[model samples]
Target: VAGQAAANQVFNSAFWVTSFLPAVTATLIAKEKAQGNEDGVQDAVCQAIFVGVFIALVTTALCFAKPNQILSSVLSQDAPAMEYARPYLLVRTFAFVPSLISLVGFSAFRGVL
Candidate 1:
């Protein structure tokens, strides 16, 4: 339970960005397309992809560096499962970038279509 909770915390931290990136990407691309600017649409997609990947990478690195701190905060310092949660959280962090980027890509596609 503690391990799963900790993993959720780490992913949730990045999830907020995921929730909003789509809106930003979709809006930018839609606006550009409405104006008939293919270059601007491409630029918007690229920028959103870059930002999403960058944020995910940074989040993963931070989780890797401070898994204990994250677990402690989410599971409480006295939580007995902190030790177990640490590894679980680290493992889960690896998926952050890929998931985020995939969502961003979908958003871009939705925008284009």
Candidate 2:
């Protein structure tokens, strides 16, 4: 759902995703056979990627939004780290929508029916 909304905004590709399930199935099936997963590896990859991206976004925000003093005490003494993290977090937050689309679109194709 999130992917669908974001894709609609970023490109008119949501319709294409909906229509592209058969190709997705063919590719995923080949991958699954290669990987030896009878249980559907595509769903597993999608869920894992979603969780990974979510964790990354959360960690980025936590480090960036909190104070330097807290971050320093918790992570490292390098001021440069926090400085670097600030922009990184902002970019990651903004990137959520696009990354979300790619992640979700690939996963969505598996269960598209």
Candidate 3:
């Protein structure tokens, strides 16, 4: 039970890192559109995607490199939950880039609307 709780907390916290992407995407689109540069909007979207992927990659690398430390900081070092949560967190980190890209896409669509 403790392990599950810890895992859930870790999972939820990690998602916070991706939460800013939508706002960023929307801002980028709006900026480009206001400047009357449709091409620039597309370019900005591409750049945003690249940036998101890069950040995810860095995050993944860090998580992999220091899973124990991260888990400990988030929970207790000896928490049974850390065992379950660490692997889940590592696996989830891989989804960040793709998820962020999708978010950016949605944001772009929202901007259009």
| Lowest lDDT 10-residue stretch of candidate 3 | 3-12
**How big is the positional error of residue 76 in model 2, measured in Å on the Cα after superposition?**
8.3
For model 1 the TM-score comes to 0.89
lDDT of 3 by residue, 1-113 (tens): 56556655665677577788788888878888988999989897888788778877777787788877877766878876778877777787677677777878898887655
* Residue-by-residue lDDT tens digits, candidate 2, 1-113: 33223323322332233334335544665577567776776664465555545654664455456634333443354644555544443443455545545655555455333
Residue pairs with backbone atoms closer than 3 Å in model 3 (clashes): 3-81
What does candidate 3 score on TM? 0.81
Which prediction has the highest lDDT against the true structure? 1
- Which candidate achieves the best TM-score against the true structure? 1
The local lDDT score (0 to 100) that residue 42 gets in candidate 2 is: 61
TM-score of each: 0.89, 0.34, 0.81
Tens digit of per-residue lDDT, candidate 1, span 53-112: 998888888889887776666687677778678878888888888898898899988888
Alpha-carbon RMSD to native, per candidate: 1.5, 12.2, 2.1
lDDT of 2: 0.47
